[model samples]
Target: MNYEAFYQKSIEKPQEFWREEATMIDWDKPFEQVLDYSSAPRTRWFTGGTTNLCHNAVDRWLPTQAKTPALIAISTETDSERTYSFEQLHSEVNQVAAMLLSLGVKRGDRVLIYMPMVAEAVFVMLACARIGAVHVVVFGGFAASSLATRIDDATPALIVSTDAGSRGKKVVNYKQLLDEAIGLSEHEVPQVLLLSRGLVSTAIVDGRDVDYDTLRQAHLGAHVPVTWLEANDTSYILYTSGTTGKPKGIQRDVGGYAVALAASMKYIFSGKPGEVFFSTSDIGWVVGHSYIVYGPLLAGMATVLYEGLPTQPDPGVWWRIVEQYEVSLMFSAPTAIRVLKKYPLENMQKYDTSSLRTLFLAGEPLDKGTSEWISNALGVSVIDNYWQTETGWPILGVATGANGKKVPAGSSGVAVYGYQVSIVDDATGAECAANEKGMIMIEGPLPPGCFQTIFRSDQRFIDSYWKQHGDRWLYSSSDWGIRDSDNNYYVLGRSDDVINTAGHRLGTREIEECIAGHEAVSEVAVVGVVDPLKGQIPIAFVVPRSLEHVADDAGRAALRDALSKQVDNRVGSFARPSAIHFVEMLPKTRSGKLLRRSIQAMCEGREAGDISTLENPEALQKIDTIISANHG
Candidate 1:
């Protein structure tokens, strides 16, 4: 299909276009209306329909794929691997649903799932959907305080968690964290279903905690039927994990989310039945929820659920899975590929990834060097798509398997189907000219699979996402972007990430990308620090190929000079960072997103809040130690 005409129809005649797409899903009842826009920002797709996410994801596939491998779970941390057939997955999901019912969980109830990357997490999520309960899967890497806020807001009837989770050599005591979070929150949670993995000793609460094994044993041979829901009923509430302030619960509906993922799998992901799909992300995030679980399963494809780091045990861990499962479609973040790129290419080349057709990257901007390096290394097409937690799927992406699509080096293609996107000025809300940078905004009613509202706060949703700009309603992405004459869009970075150096606005990513081009630099992070003269100045933290350059003051100074010169020549002298500090690693979230705000906090001699969520707190500690000893 022509990408231009296909996308145009979605915008021009959304009801007609989406009604045709709605045929992909198996709805319990046909929708009375294809599109409902009576509430401007609060649009509904396939209104008056009844459907269940679990039925579409698991049950519908069982007829043709009963014996086919539905989920392939691999945990390098524990050195275990298992694959479940469609029939087996259905049985497992039924057991969980029965267990949830035994604990007094019913339709419209909320269940909190705090677990590591294990197969049981998938079962619990599917079970929640099966019973028509809204499941909130908080990242297991979060600290107790962070978990407390979500527990209070969601007010879950029960929390399902494991005793412990392993990350490389360390074991995170999840039971301990859950106990602490329950202590902090105001809401009284009735029950805590614990999955004891025996990695650590678990102390169960006398009256509140229940063992998962015992309950599963009692519920053996259970066959809980799917709970059908209205098209607009919420499926889940994913709390946005921002650097500061309170988190927002992003709510998603039943039919719209299902239709969106189904369409994305068929058109955007090019997923097919019986094929294997792999996404190197935790189930807590939106990408994992869509591509890892719902998207692949909805398409009747076998999905791979992996636990452990990309470089753990060996850099060949992910590729080994590709060879083992013959993954046709794979999704991962750019930072992970960068970590693998730092090592020898032979590590990845040893595995036979001939079955892999394409690798999709998102979560952050992909640099040209990283993109080209991974594409060459994998010997597969590397496609980049752009989206956020608020939007359930990609806002802009090239249709998978589309021949002769002209994808630019740094662009994440054009807008996806159903998104009426534009680049507009922040102040006047006027559309920017081609090649001019502006806020990335979408004219709503948002397409199927997009977030409905901030959970329980429609007014805040309007204020935050859909705001009146003169005569039109626009959903601000809070990111700056530019569109070329060919319609390819380039996401520069977050609008707030722009640094005003002597009244010249400079994107932190623009400077970081320039610094990353230095020959000796392996990775770089740029954060804006308060400066008396320039209001905010860019400060860089670079990771070199070796620590030998940073071992001595003279070598460190020379390397910093080279990097500054590179940035000055590439970007501009005004964008050059005030000081370039060398560190072995940059602080990042467990999901591989750079912790720029945390780095900026340390640079200004302020407390780095919430170090618990950081992938490596030692990275930030090293920076502080070095600066205090020498640079200070």
Candidate 2:
């Protein structure tokens, strides 16, 4: 069915709709109520049900698909690869589950995972789910202080890490970083399981640290039963940096999360039982937890766990993997596509990408230019989806060609089944007219797969989201957006990032998109800086298609003027950037989100807050130099 029909039926009968969707997974005890909203902000889904996420993702697939490949892991820098069948994955999960139990880990205990994107990391996550432990995954590159903040907040009983992690060509000493974080945290972790991926030179604590491989070997052949948890039982707690300078833990429930992710696999991704799916996301992020680990496995498909960047060895690494594995569907952030766009078109022609069916982009606002470029480069349908960490799955996405849906270039499509998105005025919280820009809000009770509450901060959850709309009960997405005449939703940048220039408000995304349309520009970020006349004038930092242009002062100046003209024509003169600086790269998070705040800070000659999440810290100094020279 197409999205129109599916969405109509879902909204018309949400209770019956979600209840029917819950039957897709295997449950030890079925739910009595499909949704419960008596507690206002803390809405519960599939109440009165009992289920195990590990059983649904692994054990149920073992009998019929025992020999089928369930996971494909690729290491880009080392050119190493491995595959695991459903039977093998189940056995490894059980072994690790047994090991966690031996270490005194029990139901509802928090287990922090700080490792790279490896097969063992996936196994550890599933093992924690199997034993009913709430897993907390911190990104591998996070600094000790960042890790310590999460450790103190969650107070995990045990921490799982690796000796080292490889990204691109650099190896991060994860064990050493974990040690520093543990020392920094006030909370006392009882045990640490260190997986020796390569060397054993890292110092291990006498009583607290244990080798993961040794523990797994000792627990080999042990039988561990899956723990059936209530529908409201916490499945995982993922920490996300908030605007308030504190990391907030997002809590996901067992039964509802599994049901929602399974449904999303079928509807959003068009994934089948045995198709190969690859989502280029690290296991630390929410996308990895849903699409990489749980979603594909729940759909009974082979999920690719890649431990490399898209442009690691060359620009053709991702396409080569697609051809090698015959990947049917792929999902990635727009930042990767923008980076790949820098290479010549001949680079993509070297590999056969015919096996790739549909390409999905998420995690940030995708510009129309980048979306069209990727579609033409890969010769496949590219779809831009919209969602957040609080929402476990996609709230907005285009349907695949199989569903007879037209993929819009820049729009995030219509709302998915079971979600009601509305554009409302920021001041009054009143619904806006069509094609009018306003704050994006989702009317609740939110569907399954959405977060339940902020960990240990019910009031904060209410204050941050619900309180904004007063008695309306709308979940504030904190994003600015516009709904077109055809019901297509276009996400402007974050509401806070909107620039006020000469009494006119403009979105940074619009200016960035206009500048990115230039042939010489590969990626662009626009931020507002204090101005004497216009209050705050927009300035842009652009990455040229070729570094040679950046080295040539004359070429850089000419290109900047051309980009300014392009923005003025597409948007308005008020939206044109006052100054444009050609840079080597833009600061970004590992998950591919542009660190606009960091750029804004650099422009104002101030310290960027909490830059520990930056994927390339070295780029900040370059940005500062470019901004200073241009301003002078």
Best by TM-score: 1
What are the runs in model 1 whose C-alpha is more than 4 Å off?
Answer: 401-404, 549-551
Task: Judging by lDDT against the true structure, name the best candidate.
Answer: 1
lDDT of each: 0.90, 0.88
Residue 134 miss distance in model 1 (angstroms): 0.6
Tens digits of per-residue lDDT, candidate 2, 1-632, equal 66688787777788888888999999898888888978876788888899999999999998899899899999985578999999999998999999999999989999999999888899989999999999999998688989988999999999999899876678888988899999999999999999998843699899999999899889998779999999989999998853335679999999889999998888788898788999999888999999999999999999999988888788888888899998999999999889888887877888898988899999889999998888988888898899999999998887552263674688988887888888999898789999999988888878898898999988888888774456557888999999987888999989879999999998999998899899888999999988888899998988999987767878877888888888878898889888888778899888888889888977888888777768898888898777667668
Query: What residue pairs clash in candidate 1, if any at all?
Result: none
lDDT score, candidate 2 = 0.88
In candidate 1 the C-alpha lDDT for residue 278 amounts to 98
TM-score of 1: 0.98
Cα lDDT tens digits, model 1, 152-263, are: 8899999999999999858999999999999999999999999999999988798999999999999999999889999999999998876355679999999999998998
| Model 2 weakest lDDT span, ten residues long | 399-408
